[model samples]
Target: MPKPTPETLARMKDVVGPKGFVDDAAEMAPYLVERRELYVGRAAAVLKPATTAEVSAILRIAHETGTAIVPQGGNTGLVGGQIPSGTGEEVVLSLSRMNRVRALDAGNNTLALDAGVTLAAAQTAAEEAGRLFPLSLASEGTCQIGGNLSTNAGGTAVLRYGNARDLVLGLEVVTASGEVWDGMRGLRKDNTGYDLKQLFLGSEGTLGIITGAVLKLFPRPQSLATAFAAVPDVASAVKLLRVADAVSGGMVTAFELVPRIGLEFVVSHVEGASDPLPDVSPWYVLIEMSAGSATAGLDETLEAVLAEGLEQALLSDAVLARSEAQRADFWRLRETLSEVQRLEGGSIKHDVSVPVSAMGAFIARATAEVTRAMPGVRVVAFGHIGDGNVHFNLSQPAGADKAAFLARWGEMNALVHGIVREMGGSISAEHGVGQLKRDEIAATKARVEIETMRALKRALDPKGILNPGKVV
Candidate 1:
């Protein structure tokens, strides 16, 4: 696709208004740089469309001009998928203006809302209706629903709620050719020959843009419980997870694994952050349980599991949060692990997953291999153990050059992802294959799988004008 000319930019600006377009380089700074600082993009204009009609018109102009377009939401994505091109050939489509909750059906437990609405706002809407929107992420406050659905975000609650794809019942999408596909039905079961919504759910804006969605909700939990426990090792952690599942009868909501190094980073970097566990073990697990009724005995159930784990010598020590503030404090330590790692220096982060049973093995083997590759490298490994997704990050050794350490990103990714592939795991567990992992995933996936993805891309986006260099 050719670069968007001045005339094309003017006409595209008319789709919204003068206030809706951001052409100044200084003004588009936030939209240009990704959160991780991994990429810096350039765009002709940041188009903010208030309505789906305006989005359709913008796409129509881009389609006619043969200009590329990148859909951006919240700008909180870590993989640089939301940013536009670095050559200023494409326009950044911002959905922030279309932030509105369209409808909330309590009977169906579905909330149909615009894609621009923030995840936090959607959660608030669900809570107002006496329902629970279980899709919770660290970026929930800033990240919009469009990006979440586009990337199929999986958060701490995936053990019970599932990913963004599972929470979605239907979607309203704007296709590559400027046509609006209204697949928005709040039905539990649809007998349609093809499940079209799945195509755009995790497409990362390559196939189309998600304009709106019918999100599934559940009954709000009345009794909530949280605990921070330390296990002997990865194997023991996996066993304890099974014990929790068995004892809680699946009431366990979030089960996360935190290495000792991660806890130290949080305690040292984040103020007001204290170690939830009295003494640090080799590994830590943060577990939460919630029930729909007050008489569910979630606390008692978690206590029973912890007792059994202690008796079996699987757990070293465990502490249950006594108050809501304490519970939030415990979560604060887990959530801030990603941020505190930056203060430690250059880090190589991987969002990989393996089979639940093989998680311990993968972690153990990958850590050893990576350490051998980069001697003195500090590994800060932690993530949702319940779902087998771990954010295994490698920090620079003390006094090492940050730039030199970061230059080994590609080599480290190859080494770690090779292990992931061997163990039947994904290189990208939750974060989608944006420009960051686009070529990487191609190398890891099978020939038939890559060909199928390419075929689908050709069929849906023939011109390759949407998200030009990302995903397939």
Candidate 2:
């Protein structure tokens, strides 16, 4: 698509008024880049719409002018989905100004909020209502609910509450044609017709811009238990997860896999991080369980599972958090692993998922193949093993040139993704197919799937002015 004309840009800017947009290069810098700095883009302007009507107006102008509009939120996306392209012709539609808690229905266990509401803020709202919004992430403080829905984000709680799509009951979307589709019903069962909300959930802003959402909530957990266990290996960790599920009667909220190297990175680099267990193990798992009632005996349940794991040799050692502070400290270790990897040097990261049954094999085989291809490379494979999503990262070989190591990103991707394909895995799991893995998706997915995605994109965004050059 051609760049949006300056005249059209100014007209679009007027839709949101003066405070609604940013044109200065300095002011737009933050919106033009992503968290990893993997992709730096340029935009004609950054439009911050405060309301859904303003978003609709901006889209109308962009559609008429054939101008690309990249909808961005929080700017914390690992993939480049939220960032504009390098053409500098695209306009960024940021939802930051729309941050508002529309309503919280404690009786229905639902929340209606503008898309710009931060995840942390949403959680707080639910908490104040005596309910729980289970969708969470390491960037909860900054990542917006709209971006979470666009990317269908998966985090620690996904194993229990499901992905962002599952948590959302409905969406308020502004289509590429600048038409609003208000399907914001908070009903538990709405089989009236096509579930249109699913289409926009993970579309990554290509089909439409998510303006607001009606999210499902749950009873706030009255009892919570967290444990850090040292497993013998990946296989053992997988086995222990099943055991924990059975013993806890399906109370396993989050079961994360942590490689020895990743743990070492966190404890060594992250402040206030220490090994919970005394004895070292090759692999570890962070297991968390929650109960709705205070007398649910979650701690006892967790202890029983750990005891069985020990008896079966699934785990070598375990440490259960005794207090809320200790629980936070334990989580601090896991959450900081991703950021601390940078201190180790250049890292090639892959967020992929296989069937839970194949996670153990997939990690083992991929680690072996990557190591064989690049000797001395440190493999830091870790993530929500409960749902099979693994953030398989490769730290540059010790003392190796950072740029030279990063240059092989594609080579390593192919090497690792090859194993993923053989194991029937997804190339882009929780992280949506932004520019990073957009092309790779075609090669990995069946032709019918790609064609269908393109068909939807064309139908909703005929002008292709919405998040062009990303996703399908």
Candidate 3:
């Protein structure tokens, strides 16, 4: 494809009004830098289209000119997916202004929202209608629904609600040729020829730009019980997770694992954060249970499970939040973990997943390997253990040179991702194969899988104009 020229820029400005476009270096600074500060790049312009028609027009112009366009959401992606590439020839197509909740069907428990709607906003809309949109995330307040769908995000709720892909019923997308495919149906069962929505859910804007979507909703939970328990180690956490899953019988909403080091960092760096348990253990698991009926004994169920875990020696200590405020406080500690790590120093983070049965082994092996690779490195491992996804991150040693430590990102990623691949795992679990992991995916994924993805990309976007340089 040819580079974006002055003429193309002028045409783009005309397509998207003056207020919808920006080329100033200062104005584009925030969009250039990624959430993790790991990747940075320049863009020709950042175009904010307020409507899907405007998006279509801008994409049409770019398609005709053979200009690469990067689809950007709230710019809160962890893997630098929303940031432009280093070519400096791409234009960022921001969807922030396209935020809108188009329709809601309470009886059907479905919602149709524009791509720019924030995850938090969607959740609020669901709650107002007495339904639940169970795709919760740490960045729910800032991340757009489009980015979440693009990444196929999985949060603590994934243990019960499944990933973002499962929550989406239909999608309206703009293909590389600027043609909109309206597949927005709220049907629960449609034995069609093929499930095309699945192709775009986690495509990371590679084949097309998702403009709107119809998402599934569930009955709102009337009672919720949250507890924080200290465990002996990763193995014990895994055992407790199984116990909870079995005892709750699908009532278990979330099961998050947090290392002692992670809690220490949160307590020290995040304000008003304190340890959940009176005594600290090597690791902690935040367990949550929810039920739709008001009379459901969620608290009693969780209490009974905790009692059994304690009796069986699977849990070392436990603390159940007594009130809603206390429950929020407990969650605040887990949510602030990434931020606290950022305050500590430069860190190498990995979002990888393996089978639930192999999670304990993966954690042990990865920790040992990372320590051997870089002596004195502090590993801060934590994530949703129930779903087999762990953020096995590493913090630089105290007083170590930040630049030197960060320079080893590739080495660290190789050591960690190699173990994930060997154990039948994914290098980019929920973050999607954005630019950060595009090359790594190409290197690690099976030839057949990669070829299949490339074939789909060609079939949907033969000209390679839709979010170029992303995914396959």
Candidate 4:
């Protein structure tokens, strides 16, 4: 692919106007690098179009000139899908300036907003309207709805409400050809033809640029019951999840797994973090149950579930949050585990998922294999266990060089992913496949499935200018 000509770049800048384009190296630095710093990219410019029309105009120009465009949102992605290429041939089209709350129909339980709206802001908007936007993440404050939609982000609430794709009712996307496809309808049931919005939900900007969305909302919970429990092992934790769901009458909203080592990492690195339980356990499960009615007896349900878990030997110990602050403290441990891992030297992270029945076996086998493969490597396995998605991370051995441990990234991923595949799990669960796992996915995915993805890419983005060299 050829680089965008100076004239083409000029026209692109003119389309966004002065306040929307960034060309200075210093100003573009943040957009070029991701949080993990695994991959750094170079872009000719970063375009921040404030409106759909502006984005359409820019894409129209790029589509005509065949200029590569990368749609970026909040830059909070772990995978390098949002980053431009190292060749400096692409332009980062940022949706940050398009922040807006288009509409909120509380009666219909729908919230429509610009894709650039922060996840936190979207949640706040829904709350102010007496509704709940259930999709959440650790980076909710900085991550944009566009990025969340693009990645199909799955967070703590996914166990109850489903992933990002499930929360969205409609999407307004800018196709690679610069034509705007307005499918932004705030309806619960529409027997429309293709369900086209599903294609871009987790496409990672390879097919189209998501500019606005109509998000599904639910009634805000009037009562919430949170607890931190000590499970003897992962299998016990899974059992506890079943009990929690049964006792709560399917009101269990979040069930997260945290290893003892992960808790130590958080206690050591994060301020105001401490173990909620009295005794140490090999594994911990954070359980949360929410009810829309204030008199739903969530607390009683949780207590009964815990009592049953103890009777069944599923829990060694457990503590229910007596206050909201304590509840927040319990969640802080799970939410901050990803960030605190950085303090523990090099960490090879794998965001994979296995069937709920095989999660324990998969983790045990993967842990044993990785330890045998690389002795002394610390396995900090934890995540949305209710959904069977675990952030199976391996911290470098004590006093080991970070670079050397990181160098074994590919080896570790292969070993872990093999076990995951054997157990009938997905290699990339919450995290989208970006440049990091782009090639490895092709090896694991079925030929027909991979071909189908490629065919879709060709049909939607024939020029291969939208986030090229990333997914597929």
Candidate 5:
């Protein structure tokens, strides 16, 4: 793509005005770097369009000028999907300026919001309406809805509420040619010939730019219960999740696996952390149950599940949070696990998923393979076990060379992904296939499946201008 010509720049500046267009290198720095600092991109300019019409105008100008466009949200993505390329030729289109809650219909349990709305803000809006937007995530405070929907983010509540894709009812997207597909359907039962919204939900902006969304909401829980349990092993934790599901009548909202190493990191790196169990165990699983009514007896239901698990030896010991403060404290440990790992030095992480039945085996096989290849590698196994998604993280061994340990990312990915494929699992369970795993998709996905994705890309974005280099 040609550099933004003076004439083109002039036209673009007029469209969004001085407040929206950012060309100074210093001012555009944040949009160029990802959260982990793993990838730093170069952009000729960053455009902060404030409205859907402004986005269309900018895209139209870019389409006419043959300039590549990289759509960014709060810049919280880990896979380098929102960052521009190193070419310093693309125009970074930021949706932060478009933040707005367009409409909220409590009666319909649907919310129409701008893409720039932060996940936390959207949740607050739903809560204000006496509803629950159950897409909870660690980065909910900073991650924008556009990027969340674009990546189909799977968070803590996937066991019950489902992923970002499941919460979305409709999306208003700007096509490659700058035309808006106003697919803002609020109806739950739409007999549509084609569910085009699904294509863009997890597309990572390769197909189009998600400008607005109509999201599904649920009734707020009147009573909630949380438990932190010590399990002997991953297999036992898996069994415990099933028991909780059965006893709670499938009301288990969140079932997270917490390995011993994860808690160790939290205790060492995080402040005001407390171990939930009296004695340390090899594995831990955080269980949460929620009910729509106060009379549902969530605590009694959790007690039954724990009793059965204890009888079956599914867990060694468990503690249910007696107060809201205790519940928040228990969750703080799980939510901060990812951040605390960074203090332990370099770490390689994989967000993969398998069948609920095979998750335990998958983790065990991958852990064994990884440790055998590299002795002293501290394997941190954890994630949303209820949905079969496990965040298999490998923290650097004690006193090891950080650089040398991090250099094995590719080899580690191959080893772990191989086991995942054997178990009929996805290489990317929650995080989308951004630049990090783009090429790996070719090897992991079937020939026809790969071709079908490429076909859709061509059909929607024949110019290959939207997020050009990321995610096939």
Candidate 6:
């Protein structure tokens, strides 16, 4: 619990070379801060280990010295799961140097990759082997696999592929006591025991540091069809989703809902972005369908679905992309929403989920409550409606003081998350319970749930030296 001593620092430097251990404030500044700029912290040193054995050795030293270790990946996490917590007593264990693709078994449909590999790189490696790694995220180009697994990220493809937890087959983790637990099996059905890998999948590095993993792969889709349809509201979007699911028979990969305000923000702020449809409506649903076979009727199927939706009054207007370039352009508008909002002004963001049946009610009720709480606030609501997850974000009114608006984050979060809980939803859907949501977890979760999580943490990490003060 005490601050690390000079002797401890010297020992850490010895475990990893001088170049591997960084203590200079200038050198450690980036690792000290988080992506959201919400959680700022200090670290005694940032240790970069090149291999799993090196990570184990560094962890052993930290464990023996009773020094807290915060495992960091690409530092692209929205929550403060990667940065130190300003205690200035902990050391950041950086996995950037551990980046490597160990194996790609096409026959087994799995890729054994180091935890430090970027999500995009892993996807590319899978593609080279004529397979698909379907865990797609907006931050795929920068976020590491370890952070993705720690957070159990859900991106656009989750409707068909599931979340990051589903894509993982096995994990190689270093526990708090510096013992490596190797469970990297590529088996599809191994009901041999307790399935311990699930414990660390979304633990946010609290129980242990995941060094590498065996990830599942799927057959690459040979054709993709994208469309943008304007719905009367969230309810209509939900109805259309049900129809699409039934029509496509599980080929509906993504179903995103965007508000008019969200699209306006993207068009106005993001360069080279334009409206996907000829006329805009109050709400829009971006749908994507893919098939592994070389099928030419995907476009025809999408068009038929849209025509039926129009006839049923489930959609107000729709546009189906005729070419691949046009399809990419349509998706670019949806992908650039978050960045455009950031460029516009200070925004309060929430990544929450509810039951599919309650999603429409949650969105409508939360929008009304939040607008009432802060008049003139621009509600930029959009996200994976098919999975009941919404990025219900709110931007301050133009010309409003940024500091003052951001100061009300807690109030806004309470208003939105309260509705989510009432609808039997989660406060943090894909993002894990990092430092940002620790207190929120205490407030929102049942006593038994919190107590059970704490018990698991205590059982796996008795000394509590691994990523201390995170999650439970």
Candidate 4 versus the native: TM-score?
0.99
Q: What tens digits encode model 4's per-residue C-alpha lDDT throughout 1-472?
A: 6898889989988998999989999999999999999989999999999999999999889888888998999999988999988999899999999899999998899999999999999999999999999998999999999999999999999999999999999999999988999999987788968799999999999999999999999999999999899999898889889888787789999999999999999999999898887888999999999999999998999999999999999998889999989989998999999999999999998999999978899899999999999999999999999999999999999999999999999999999999888888999999999898899999889999999999999999998889999889
Candidate 6 lDDT for residue 457: 88
**Local distance difference test values of all predictions, in order:** 0.91, 0.93, 0.90, 0.93, 0.92, 0.89
Candidate 1 lands at a TM-score of 0.99
* Candidate 3, superposed: residue stretches over 4 Å from native: none
Give the least accurate 10-residue stretch of model 5, judged by summed lDDT: 1-10
Q: Over 4 Å off in model 4, which ranges?
A: none
Instruction: Identify the leading candidate in terms of lDDT.
Output: 4
TM-score of each: 0.99, 0.99, 0.98, 0.99, 0.99, 0.98
Regions more than 4 Å wrong, model 6: none
How big is the positional error of residue 334 in model 5, measured in Å on the Cα after superposition?
0.3
Report how far residue 191 has shifted in candidate 2, in Å: 1.3
Tens digits of per-residue lDDT, candidate 2, 42-158, equal: 998999999999999898888887888999999999889999988898999999999999999999999999999999999999999899999889999999999999999999998
Model 4 CA lDDT for position 5: 89
How many backbone overlaps does candidate 4 show?
Answer: 0
Candidate 4 colliding pairs:
none
Model 6 lDDT per residue over 1-472, tens place: 5678899888878878887899999999999887778888999889998888888887788778888899999998787988888779999999888789999999999999899999999999999999999998888898899989988989998899999999989999998878899989999999988999999999999988999999999999998888999998898899999989888877899999989998998888877888877876999999999998876588888888898899999998888888888888788888888888877789999999999877788888999999899999999889999899999999998889999999999999989998988888999988777888888898778999999999998998887888888887
Q: Could you give me the TM-score of model 6 versus the true structure?
A: 0.98
Candidate 3 structure, TM-score to reference: 0.98
Encode model 3's per-residue lDDT on 21-59: one tens digit a residue.
899999998888898887798899999988888888887
